[model samples]
Target: MKPEAKNETQEMHRVEMTIGTILRWGVIVAAAIMIVGLLFYLVDGSLGVASNYHVQNFHQLLQGLIAGKPYAIMMVGIFALILTPVLRVVVSIYSFYREHDRLYVIITSLVLLILLTSFVLGIEFQL
Candidate 1:
């Protein structure tokens, strides 16, 4: 193996490590956010009422977040957890494209498309 090929391999490994670190930190941050929200809810004495499982609209959720609503913060944390995998897929798409891996780029693009389609449908159907 040539030194150039070894360097390329190292670069790919670094990219993979970076993506892995991003996912790990994403989950950690999301969990911390959720924990804080839970603590806030408990401290605020909102646990007595039954919490609805309805998904809040993004705009409303953002407003609630600005208003310091615990539930809204929790929902935002959930969204971050959900987005981690989508972010991974996007990163993979870019990596494959840079490597000129046509097949992988197409496959990863399809995965991304499906993920986005599901999110849109979920919002539209309120599911």
Candidate 2:
């Protein structure tokens, strides 16, 4: 009933709420990553066997990964696209740990990475 006690309770409640929010978003992100992985698997299957099978442009945006085509290089370069965001998240996680903050790090990193990646990759490289 004391003012100090009420403040403590409010602070604990806020921390709990923030933790719950982070957990929810983490789960959603994990699910999305899983779905995308599954799609990649399906696309891989459509690539077919290596010895005699062929994958046509009907299913491929570029000739094929091994064809050493420019589009293939570009497509492979897309993997590098993840570097900035991954680095940002790593830095933000350390920042959060040092600051004793919650997973706002993830949100902040995502936003920072998106803006940076858009400017660097989308505009500069046209990727």
Candidate 3:
């Protein structure tokens, strides 16, 4: 292949590697956070305390998180787990844009839009 082609291929590979790293680390970190929360619950024996699931808004969620609530921490980990793939979609959009692959950029952008819309609906409808 031409030098330019080789360089482009290398760049794409690097981008793929970055996406893989993001997913791997996202899951690992989220899992670790969840495990810590679980251990805290086990040691503290706070299962009787009701989980604050009706987190009316982001501010409430942050307040719960700041208060060191186990369920809130676990939910944050789960949210991170759920968002990892959406992050991949975002990175994919950037990679495609870098490659000047307009079609894929548009496709990935649409995927991101759908993901955001669903998240919004989930928060609004308490799904």
Candidate 4:
């Protein structure tokens, strides 16, 4: 094996190690975001109902929420639902940047756009 070939192998190994570290940390960040958000709900007080107007109930909020995946706690669930995806995004972006992956960045962005469009569109269709 040529000296230059050995050098290349070492470089590849280093790159792989870096990528693995980034991925592991990314998963950790996402999980932490979810867990922290959930804890907030458990420790916080409940959202007080201003007044229960039997004649004028806002089922829209309930319908929109129920149509989607049920959250564990209303506040924490909402935060966790939003935060986890966002944390994943931060992780993906961070990993892509660390790996210097232009193509992956483009693909991630496209997928996010599609997912967001679908989520928004879903709400509209629910009504």
Candidate 5:
């Protein structure tokens, strides 16, 4: 194979590996956070508190986190879990753009736009 083609292949492989590592670490970190939150809840004797707790927005979430609220910590973990794939999509868009693959870049961009729109609409309609 031409050296240029080989280098491109290696670059693509590296990108794929980086994406995989991001996904793996994202899940691991999220799970660890959730476990810590569960442990806090269990030890703090707040078993039923989460049932009544609702975080209204990022501000509230941050406040609760600062106050050492277990549910807030768990919510953060959940958010991280949800964002993992979205991050992957973002990375894929960058990877395709780097490779000059316009078709995939456009497709992934649309996917990201749809994801963001859904998030906006969901937040707007949320009670």
Candidate 6:
């Protein structure tokens, strides 16, 4: 292979590895947060009553988090989990842009746009 092509291949490999690492760490961190929250709930003996609990919005989530609410912590973990793939899409867009792959960059950007749009509409409609 030409040296230029080989270097480009290696760069792509590195980007893939970075993306993999991001996904791995994102899941691991989210799971850890959720586990900690679960443990707190178990210790507090609030598991039974948790069903009726609701966090109305981000502001409430923040307040609950500040007050050390286990459910709020769990919600944050859930948010992180949901965002992992969105992050991957964002990274893919950047990677494609770096490689001058306009088609892929556009495709990935559209995927990201769809993801964000769905998230917004889901929240707006409370779905």
Per-candidate alpha-carbon RMSD to the true structure: 2.0, 10.4, 1.8, 8.7, 1.5, 1.7
Candidate 1 colliding pairs: none
* Model 5 / residue 88 / CA error / Å: 0.5
Off by over 4 Å in 1: 47-53
User: For each candidate, how many residue pairs have backbone atoms clashing (under 3 Å)?
Assistant: 0, 0, 0, 0, 0, 0
Give one digit per residue, the lDDT tens place, for model 5 in 62-89: 9888888888889999999999999999
**What local distance difference test score does each model get?**
0.85, 0.53, 0.85, 0.54, 0.90, 0.88
lDDT score at residue 87, model 4, on the 0-100 scale: 51
| Model 4 global lDDT (CA atoms, 0 to 1) | 0.54
Clashing pairs in 6: none
Instruction: Put down candidate 2 lDDT per residue, 50-102, tens digits, no spaces.
Output: 55543333235354445543333434344444443454456555556545566
Candidate 6 residue spans exceeding 4 A from truth: 47-50
Better of 2 and 6 by lDDT: 6
Candidate 1 per-residue lDDT, tens place, 13-35, comes to: 98799789879989998999899
Using Cα atoms with residue i matched to residue i, what is each candidate's TM-score against the true structure?
0.90, 0.37, 0.91, 0.40, 0.93, 0.93
Model 5 superposed RMSD (Cα): 1.5
- The residue-by-residue lDDT of candidate 3 on 48-120, one tens digit each, is 2465546667787687678777776777788889989988999999999999999999999999999999989
Q: Give the range of the ten consecutive residues with the poorest summed lDDT in model 4.
A: 47-56
**Candidate that would win on lDDT:** 5
**After best superposition, candidate 2 residue 120: deviation in angstroms?**
33
Q: Under the 3 Å rule for N, CA and C atoms, how many clashes does model 2 have? A: 0
